[model samples]
Target: MPVDLETLYPKLVNLLLDPVFVVDESGNIVFVSDACESLLGYTASEMIGTLIFDYLHPDDRERTRAEANRVMTGHPHTNFENRYLHKDGHAVHILWSARWSEDDKLRIGLARNVTSLRRANQTRDALYRISEAAHGADSLRGICDGVRQVIAELFPRNDLHLAFYDPVRTVLTVPDWSVDRANDWVEGSMQPGTALAEVISLGQTLLASRDPSQPGLGVITESGLKSPGPLNWLGVPLISNDSVLGALVIESQSEHIRYCAADQELLQFVATQVAIVVERKRAEDHLRFLAHHDPLTGLTNRSLFYDRLETALKSAGRHNSLVALLYLDLNDFKQINDTLGHEAGDQLLIETARRLEQCTRETDTVARMGGDEFTVLLTDISDLAAVDAAVGKIREVMAVPMMQEGQIVLISFSVGVALYPQDGRTARHLLGSADSKMYEHKRRRQAG
Candidate 1:
């Protein structure tokens, strides 16, 4: 039997995966294949009579129109790219191979949906930038700012929120850039059932909408969103080493916007990188704190104290002012440590450090030189009377009784004072003189 080529040709065109479009010189859709419905959510019958420009995304219309005009001028374009509005309203990226046919007075075009490919490229670029942010940023805030900028480029007109969980405090903290409901919502506990909370606690990506069937799982309605339409939210947990550290959330309230499955996947991937960076930065900060601080008392350590004392001596030399060093030995600290457990001894030491800090000015430096022994660097001393007054204040504050391990305990300091230039010139000489005087005072008390 002979075949009818005309009938078979339409069937063959419809069988192709990519949609074929035929628009007249006036830019009206004269013919479209059935495959377009799969790519655009619009049936061929509905699209045939509509203006082709009607489907072009508003942001891409100007460029797309220019391309169309060039094609109508007898130029064929194979690599032109633009965005078209899907029937459901999200953007559909289209790559075109098109030409103008003078005989038919029609513009023939083939469209390949490149939305997924374009998103993949964007994700790759975003990941590289985020990694740079992690390595180059000096602080947590800087890192977050960089990440927010990269994310904003990927999803424009969307609000981004980063909620971090403080495992020690059991609180969720949002950075300052967060907007409206997220700022308010993230302040408290990561309570169960909340959208963000669920993302972190369950270590899962969540897609929520105003649709009743997909209930936002306690999505905050009073988010103060100014847009007048259904709200949509996508949250992905930032997980590191199998632990849920926080959540990265993007929200939109525009009727035309929706958070789809691809968005959820991409965000989740990006959040993994974010969690690693944040965790690394926090660890670096903690290590830096430990290096300069006493672990037990949270005061400056011996090494930092010496550096400050040397700096103070140089400054006092230039200013012609006297600096004093006070070496303090806790009275019978060992006896207390023996009577009560080490934990109670630690509490006493922490309390003593606080009291010592309270007695010193902000300009002075307080340090723990190991084993209930501490040193204070006093700067800008006027004369001997000023030094005496500072010593008197320390004695008065230390005389108060403290409750430790359900027992009333009294603590005092057998303090030794060393004046700059008068006792010794250098930091080592000053420390040696102070230590000798402290032992002398302790021995006198024992004799008395």
Candidate 2:
């Protein structure tokens, strides 16, 4: 064996699972073993004449070249890792061991494919990061942002979209997306039968490319209206409890990058975690909304109104300012409920709340106390005229006829105005004084 080492070199290379290569000083591959076909998806005959740097991942080429330069100059490199492009266009992670052959003027290297091992490590790390985000993010938006970051770490992405489906409304809406591609997909409602809708309907992950044969799977690019030519797209449904809540989508227009089955699996895993967190956040938000807002009109309820009023009083006291409290009651509301039915009465209340909201400024607060009674708090008032004008606007707006069930119903409001520091010093006092004044106005109207 020692007598004929050079004669047995080819036989030894054939027995190794890892690919062996010999390259010249110019980085041209001079010799490549048959095992390259399994490691790089290219046969030795196809890779023998090609430049070694040509097969490397573009982003990793400079560093790889620098390391190779050091290895060629009388040094050995062991277990140096770099990414190369497979013939199928996916990344092939490789761990290389190389030494310079001074007599032959070539670099002899052995390459072991580590793509699966690297992907496994990345998957574990990504899941850990996603778990942290799921538990630590303060809001739904924060969770989505963390998801986007984790995805970007694993792959190159041009656009990432997080859409939420409203089951009750049968519509899909994008809540988070990259800024450059923000307008790529319209943020409003997406109708049924669209690509995203079909994904939700099927509750399956979709991997789409710009292939004409694949209809209804077009890539969404700059201004969702244009054609996405030669791009790759992946969408995974965010499913919770066997229900599809929405989708997570990623798009890439680069020719160098394409998504594969492994990428799809990873995205599906992340989507599952996202779905759980999103569902919990939505439920919490719904409960919080119910606690702070009136169920009937979607306006601030009594509890929230008192908290705001207290805060406003404190601010007013600090600035030596005045606040206006308008207490309003619909006259003969019970008669309308009795004659027209509760449905008509509810419609009237909802419309009245809308008009009251329109009659106030952005700084003002409108709240429904219960049973046909509403209150408006106008803060930081410099003069009484502003409060008077607001009252007049409300009266004029309410004078218009409202349509309820194909019938025109005329409504009137008795409004009582209370000024801060003059009417009362506290929220309770101000509220009681305004209620008493509202009843006095109602009695006067009845007498008239």
Candidate 3:
């Protein structure tokens, strides 16, 4: 058997990079290399004459032997990868090239280390996780949430701020934003030359490790709005369509890694993605706002009123409280439309809605039923006097004349109230009862 290889030229064996082994027809390891000691924790002398099947990872051995048998005919095959048991008891991923020998009594194979390549595959899988997570985020705030989640991988447990630019304000405006929020968000305006403003002003990324160069954020950290603060910070600007649209700002906790250049690069890439999402979200919000709100009065149109009414009804039912529906129709609505035209009539309706809203509590709802018609939902009522008091206040607010082309025109609303369970439980039933009551009041006043 070629003098058992060791008995022949044993010195030539240690030159290969792969863990080479010669197996006899009986599948025993007749010879091995010095590489075996480094790869498998077995010295060549100790492994020689051992079974080749014994050294293979037990789970892979049978399938590997089957594959080897299929390719036993001497043909140069290339590039296959698999795993094997390592010396430290961890599995080693290996790239393999194997072929059968001409002697028919033995076979040989070569392998290359592939651990780094495997780790890269794991990173690719993580990238897929980000894409899947970010897919549903189409608005600025939704985009903010997506960015918050991705950034969470680095900073994990800190809250972050998101702001977007307002073209009219020429400043960074609060985006759909939250504070460590699960679902709630607030959209509003913020002052210029503020903390986020500094980031947008720089027109570049800012990494604040020990101390930030931006005085706005630095001042806030040293001393907050109420008092001074000790927090260190980092801020990055989001750019889209060649302009800085906003800034994504994150603050570090005491134990955080010192924010570095690499961190800035990662943040920049994430912010770019976030900017695209926020832009789309704003467009969608504008469209949605237009669809559900009144173009003239800015009141909840019939559609939205009914939606809110249903929600209020369900909530009132749960609390075992009452819901009062008020239907107001202007007595002189047609006269204003006829004399001053629809423009004057529209102004009167808008002013009426404003006055009604002003008279109601935050929990109360005021809605425009249509031209010359308005509705109010007085919820969580403890007594009938609450309804009487609310109607009295609305009548007083509406009594004030609205200015129309330098003329003060008085508008009176004939208001009607319908109570839940006593008047009706259904929305349409409540509207019918309220409408009938309004006309009855109108007739009684007309006769008097």
The model with the greatest TM-score is: 2
Predicted candidate 1 versus true structure: per-residue lDDT over 67-95, tens digit per residue: 89999999999999998878766778899
- Model 2, residue 24: distance off in Å is 1.9
Candidate with maximal lDDT: 1
**Model 1 per-residue lDDT at 221:** 39
Give lDDT: candidate 3, residue 186.
Answer: 45
The per-model lDDT (C-alpha) reads 0.86, 0.83, 0.69
TM-score order, best first, reads 2, 1, 3
- Better model by lDDT, 1 or 2? 1
Q: List the residue pairs that clash in candidate 1.
A: none
Residue 43 in candidate 1, Cα distance off native in Å: 2.5
- Summarize candidate 2's per-residue lDDT along 1-448 as a digit string, tens digits: 2569887889899789999999999999999998999877899889988899999988899999998899889889888999888786677889999999989999999999988898899888888988888788877777877887988887754467678777887666665344575553434566554556667778887665543443233443444454344336778899998988889877666666666787788778788878888889888889999999999999999999999999999999999999999999998899888988999999899999999888888899999999999999999898999888889898998999988878788999898888898999899999998999999999999999
TM-score of 1: 0.80
Stretches of candidate 2 exceeding 4 Å from the true structure: 1-8, 165-186, 189-202, 210-231
Q: TM-scores for all candidates?
A: 0.80, 0.87, 0.57
Better by lDDT, candidate 3 or 2: 2
Q: Write the number of the candidate with greater lDDT, choosing between 1 and 3.
A: 1
Backbone N/Cα/C clashes per model? 0, 0, 8
lDDT of 2: 0.83
Model 3 agreement with the true structure over 1-448: per-residue lDDT tens digits: 2456755555565777677767765678777778777766778888788776665655567787776675576654567666565543334557777777766657776666775576456445435544655577654555556666666754444446676666676654554443465545544554544556566776677544323443224333333344133334567888878778878777655422334443455566667666666566667787887788888888778898888888888888888889999998898789878988888777777778788889999888888877788899998998999999999998888888688867888878787899996998888888899989998888877887
